[model samples]
Target: MTFSIVGRSDDGKAVGVAVASKFLGVGAAVPAALADVGAVATQSYANLAYRPQALALLGTGVSASAALAGLIAADDGPVSHRQAGIVGMTGPGATFTGADCHDWAGGAAGDGYAAQGNMLAGPSVIAGMEQTWLGSSGALPYRLLAALRAGDQAGGDRRGRQSAALLVVSPGRGYGGTSDVWVDLRVDDHVDPVAELGRLLTMHSLYFESPEPSSLIALTGPVAEEVRALLAAAGFGGEELEEELASWAGVENLEMRVVKGSIDPLVLTHLRAAG
Candidate 1:
């Protein structure tokens, strides 16, 4: 009935999931992630509670295997009809697919990822999804996207493709670092859901990614104004922003914060001038 990929970012500071289903609003039911506890994907006769309960266990130092046991033990559902995957905060991952999950439902778990699917077109479909994911050598977001595409190419849901979603977050990469969601986009019923997701991700990178302090670049002339324009266009502003920008106008190679909807005057000035 569903398909999903759950994993931590390469840097290990973030955890996220991408999932889709013929079912409506698959994002609301299949994906869940805690800033520190990892992620969960519970499908089939979907158990929404497993999302939070599993995270709660992972929160208390539970390994992915233990957290899964606790969740399964709590559920009375017969194993044949249930399917799920979990990536624990410790970074190890785990997943399970019941005997009765439609035609070709199954999964693979690894050091940093959990992949699962049910009601697939066939066994080969799941295999292709797994192969592409394993063979992928790219960013977490890209790998997850490729896995989804492989599944679709393999036959996808016998019912057809309707919606898809992508979400990735790092320790402080989220908005201002607290209660922030780094990437949260969904396509409920698009003709090209995956392609649309890729587009959104590209936009996200442009607006949110900031240069690391260690790689600070010296700026002069129109560079400062360009940087400010970029930041402003991305919607970052605040009372103290001007002060930070002023400092950057004089200092070269100073690291600047580029938070959306927040002020980081130094980065703002650099960005504005760079443009």
Candidate 2:
């Protein structure tokens, strides 16, 4: 069984999902996303084909419900067992839990989001997942993690935790420019997968958080001296490098824009050591 969150970012540049389960390699089994198209999670006696085929359908302007319906119609055993959720590019979402699934199985879907789980402790698992998604107020990854945590708190897999994962994608990162994935994380096997997932989520946020607007960090006049000293201590060189850094400016709150390449390197260093 599993619980998850799939949703779009506020600025709409990103879409993704995060999930955790008491199953082996849940990462490999439960989550999928395509840049700017949509995201899906299939769990509990999953049929992995649901991922790529659904993404293909989503890319062609099909709605989440339609894509899922197509899958069910095409499959000979659609009703035998399993659960799934889909979120389309236009923000519509839908979910299905087969009648043959194990105890405490079902799902929730809505605009810009979807979540699903089967073989859970009770209906509260799905309800807590939905509440966590509705309750979260920050970035996409945080919301997803919150939902997973909520599901766990509400009695997740009656079997206990073993694996977790998060998948995210967005358009034109650097290469293809049409469909560039931004984030994908997984905890394949762990004694406490959700705990590992939270640590990973904290590290993931530093890399993907957007730049803050200039109006919020316009310190000028004498305050510039203090800013220079702080930057120097933090890693930037003296006034010349500070002047160069000033071109991007407001590096404090908007750390992503100023960090090397992207924010992932430093976060990874810390995480690797922690794990």
Candidate 3:
């Protein structure tokens, strides 16, 4: 009832999982990752314990294959009904499909990624994911999302789509650089969950990601005056323009794009729209 990709960034700095399924709240169950460690997607009679167990092994410097082996060894239930994909920060990816999993259930692994599914429409689902993961170019989150979308387009879980999720982790990439969860977006219930997940990713980038250096506009001249006017109109007027803008940004959740001497075009656009 699920399809997923677990992968590490080509630079070895990030790891994540993207999953979609007919199951409600698939994000809460199938995907797990740790910065600089590895990612796991446990489904098809998923043993939730496999998530932490796999991460623990990879955190200890074991390869993905070894971690998977350990998981199978430690399982007490019907391992034949389980399916999993694991990718460590530094090693070849690994995957497993139990003999008794639903039809069309299987997985594939390459140097830095694994693609897997169960109760899929056909082999095309996994094939599409593997092809996309290898061919797509971008940050880890984008690449993982592309693979998931490909799988969805090729025919994901035969049952249908209800939920989807994307999770990526990297060192100090979280909000305020205080954690490792760089991106965690979920569509708990949607008719088109994969596309909804993509929309959320775009929103995440706007609110959480920092602006590119080239995209910064100096907060002087006309731009600064415009911002000041917008802030005042929004009832954030204060003696100091920077302080007032900061206050407005806090309220708008655009603090991540706020700079000391310049403003992200997105921040300005958002302020203008809000005003």
Highest lDDT: give the candidate number: 3
Per-model TM-score, in order, reads: 0.76, 0.77, 0.97
Candidate 3 lDDT, 128-246, residue by residue in tens: 99999888877999999999999999999999999999999999999989989999999999999999999999999998998999989999999889999999999988989989998
lDDT of 1 by residue, 176-227 (tens): 4565477777887777676777787776654455554554444434654555
Candidate 1: global Cα-lDDT?
Answer: 0.73
lDDT, model 2, position 232: 57
Compared to the true structure, candidate 2 yields what TM-score?
0.77
Q: Please identify model 3 stretches exceeding 4 Å from their true place.
A: none
List of clashing residue pairs for candidate 3: none
> Highest TM-score, which number?
3
Model 2: per-residue Cα lDDT over 1-275, one tens digit each:
77777787767667788888878888888788887788888776788998998899999998899998887777666555868888877866888888988887888887778878878888898888887787777767777778888888888888898998988787765222443766677899998888898897676555444434432333354444545554555566465643545443344333443433222233323323433
TM-score: model 3 vs. ground truth:
0.97
